[model samples]
Target: MMEKADICHIVMYPSPGRGHLMSLVELAQSLLRRHPSLAITVLISSPPHLLPSIIPYLSSVSSATPSIAFRHLPPSPSPSLSSAPTAFSDDPAMYFEYARLNNPNLYHDLSELLSDSQPSQKPKALVVDFFYSVAAEVAAALRLPTYYFLPAGANPLAAFLYLPTLHKLTTSSFKDLDGNVDIPGVPPIPAKHMPSRMLDRSSRIYGHFLETSTRLAESAGLISNTFEALEPRALKAISEGLCVPDGRTPPVYCIGPLVAADDHISKHECLIWLDSQPSQSVLFMSFGSMGVFSSKQLREIAHALEKSGVRFLWVVRYPPPHDEMWRNLAIKPEDDPGIDEILPSGFTERTKDRGLVLKSWAPQVAVLSHDSVGGFLSHCGWNSVMEAVFAGVPMIVWPLYAEQKLNRAYLAWDLKLVLAVAESEGGFVTTDELAERVSELMLSEKGREVRGRAAEMRNEARQALSEGGSSRVAMAKLVDSFKKGMM
Candidate 1:
């Protein structure tokens, strides 16, 4: 007799950011590993990238697993959303305004597409992105088994997926200007601490994002790109929020920081350097893919790293400046988009013995797990935050871009799990400040205390991956649902 297949999985997500896209792809890979008999298909909004290397990694899922496949759906044609200049490329204030105007139809078109697709075997299950819960509405209409896949950090999703309700309780639930509010699950997430963009109610698009994500949180099961122990309170809240009519809550699993074996183009060099440094001595820094700093701020960061007098590893992947190009543009920093001259002069040489720098994709998990690495200086991206916590490293949070500033408060102040580095006068901090913060973390007693707690968190995080772990249990139940159609 021919071999039999167990389940058919269809995954849907829109890839506006690397973190979201990467998490969706990893979940597919993980499901493939655990249940090799499953046939998985991932549906994305587009089949392109700004950086060519991103194209490969995005497409890596297909290469890694022959049993898994991909399909692309176009965003319904629109005048502005159709290849427009984002604010960073032109004017930030205006671009976001445009995105806000386009939400209703954008949601409608995606929802319609999910509704129209017909599967031959009744799709063993539907796994959808947290941001596109409208797709879940379609899946529900079709009566297909469904699961929610959050493509960002679990803690953030746990908070955001509940934002509309949270907004109802606090006056600060809004669209403009940063405000702080207490997120009941975690510690107090201050209203002033909210990301500026998320506070605007006038923006239909922002509202849609929160509304859609919140719906996904209430699905039959919620899947996170994180482990349970990292943010137990948030995970529990998410579990309770998705309660079924029968007094049962949907399953929520945290299996993440989906460390890619290779980024599809380059090998990870950070791991090699980590081997050379002493235990907890190297401060690992990466501002996430979208991190941007003015020329002045860039210089200050270089200065700070140099002044710290601590061994470090940093990844710089910015595109070349308008006026300056990398000396070996066509190659050299091979995997990088092109950022050599964008870096400060003599900075690399000044810290040569103590620092190791890479221009492109480097092995992140390997570096975090290395003995030489101690603290992480991060941009507060959920994936990066999860990785640091899972690895048991304390963080020096320096949020530079995107909803990250909101996360900074959660990590540094609310959780008391990571140290928060203050932003400077010009909305950007200087290297002197960075160096000073480095000292506070490495040389001071307060730094030692935070590190001690972070180390303790590390053990707790690992326990979630152990046998009978919460995350493991969730994953098993999810897989079982696909076969039994309990979803």
Candidate 2:
């Protein structure tokens, strides 16, 4: 064990969402595992609405890892929807604003942290989430080196770095564009298939994203939660400056497959159920944390699952209100309607023999790593995609929001490791389409091919993290750059 005076400290600031927070925490853990002489302090500025769900994970990390500390910044008020912004105050923009509002608190707390530390223990670098690029200004004000940590793959990083150029090339919203948007490294994405947040150019969220993407080049370096073998072309495009044509791109680091640590305390019921199934027999369906569907969509999915006849475990959250007025209400877990209320009548009884439907949450990392789990019906969030990839589980990509569609495009088209589920207008997946996709993913020859690719990538991911591997080498370079105070 290293003495306090011998340790190198680093500060990390993650954006508000659980996915963002979890990814950064995983990265911190990975760093400490490789460099025990390093101490990491994660500054969390959790939004009020998301605080409850984030607390348990925070507690768990704190208890499990003493070297990785967390300091909770004072909660900032949510951006008022009535305050002159367009009727498009989405969650992404709100999270950005929330983080921006905490800049003063961050500066004060960070200053004290640095001032109180021994000279050798002072933070060598400050890492901010991709969405929290604005915090880079605070880091700069403190004369600290800043790095942008993107808890995503290189494909999305390429698209984000290219946003400024894309903005200049088109005047209309992405949804209104006449043709495909050409992004470096990835396949030509249909304008409509762009991230939902980037669809409406006039929205404040799009403005935030554009500004964040533009400022990304100002960082000392970018550390992505991806490896070379997983996204070779995309990483190459970024390294070659194809993503940022107008500016000098910062050094890119490919070190990833970082996922949440599993707390092997007790066996979850879901895992026990998996134990009863055959190897590679169960299809695990889980949308991300904020993934919720309407009642109509729930029924359609129920119908699909029943028709597919595949053994499955599905985590279902309460359906959002149909009325826009009630959509923002904070629904408590205790208030969540019963499974019977949300699903089709008698759906649970019909599928009980071969399927298990969990309410709202499950041990996602453990489930994906289980042998009984074969295919994933996922929202294609970067973290979820990484988890599935690391587990070698094939997927049926059903993206919901954020950059998930972009992730879907990469997974389905570029990587060919997952099958894409087509959605009808209004983003509804019909029973037929969902059933067919599930069958194709679970039983078809194409599914077998995709599975093979996923397994190969999984091996590649393992190798990249092994001793003297590509990701390990990159990690060493990143640490060296920080130690040398290189910009």
Top candidate by lDDT: 2
Model 1 spans with C-alpha error above 4 angstroms: 1-5, 14-18, 47-55, 74-76, 79-120, 169-179, 241-251, 261-275, 317-345, 424-426, 484-487
Candidate models: Cα lDDT each: 0.63, 0.86
Model 2 Cα lDDT, one tens digit per residue, 385-454: 8889889999999989878888887778877888998998688899999999999989889889999999
lDDT of 1 by residue, 1-487 (tens): 2254434545455444455667777777776776676666665453233334346665666776886666555543454554553422343333333333434444444454445455423355667655455665555655656677765555666556656666566554453335445554655554545555565655654666666655654566777777665666776665675322223356676666455544324445567667777888988887776765554566677778877788888876664343234343444333454344666767777788999877644667667777888888888887788777777888898876556766776677767888877775446776667788898887789889999998888777667656777666666777777776424
Tell me the lDDT of model 1 at 467. 74
Question: For model 2, which pairs clash?
Answer: none
Clashes of each: 22, 0
Find the candidate with the highest TM-score and give its number. Answer: 2
